[model samples]
Target: MSAAEFSYKLRVYIEDTDAGGIVYYVNYLKFMERARTEFMRELGYGKDAIFNHGLMFVVRDMAVRYLRPAQLDDLLEATVRLIDLGGASMTLAQEVRRGAEVLATATVTVACVERAGVRPQRLPRDMTDSLRAARDTNGN
Candidate 1:
């Protein structure tokens, strides 16, 4: 990652909106999740790889604010940035923007846990280092 490492962009689809044509509030979380997945993919680790290690990522907490509304077919961009990474948990700052207008913002905390009992576990050292490097390089 670098100072310019912004998250990926994803266009909104009709299916992502509500009957009134505005994006459904819950879908913002979906967008954020996708951005996080892509962020990990860019780091050479996919969901399967993480799960194969008997580890799974779960949303521990989140705070979201909706500032504007997005309609179906809008080209929405979702950005995800690491805020903090601890031994077993990490926090992210995520946003959904339509061009210059920020539609929504969220701070999400995720924890690494064993898939079975959902017990918290330390993230792999290499993975943790990689996330830290991304955060550092991205100036997040």
Candidate 2:
């Protein structure tokens, strides 16, 4: 990916903060997840559609680095980039930014599995094609 595409903006609310008025560390994960879900939606495979195909995406692993704390009422933007795609899994590089400053960064690996038993399954060809197209276009 170009590293500049697949982005979404959100406002930090009081509910997303901790007792100290700083954004709770875990809420950054939720922001990144929402961005990823919206990225899929923009590609035509929303959450429901993917689930209807008997496939589900599950986070296999994640590593996050917090550079700074965000507070309530902050306008944050999250960007998601496709880093690697595998037979049954994909890796994404995501970040939360305030203007030009990166507040946090995360590398998330997600696996496609059958909804019944969480068994790994190959991603649908169409879905893969769409993801590749998005990545390629963004990379340019």
lDDT of 1 at 125: 90
lDDT winner: 2
Clash pairs detected, candidate 2:
none
lDDT of model 2, residue 134: 83
In model 1, where do residues sit more than 4 Å from their true spots? 1-5
lDDT of each: 0.87, 0.92
Query: Candidate 1: lDDT of 6?
Result: 49
Q: Looking at model 1, report the run of 10 residues with the lowest lDDT sum.
A: 1-10
How would you encode candidate 1's per-residue C-alpha lDDT over 7-70 as one tens digit per residue? Answer: 7788889899999999899999899999989988888679888988899899999999999999
lDDT of 2 by residue, 84-128 (tens): 989999999999999999999999999999999999999999999
Clashes of each: 0, 0
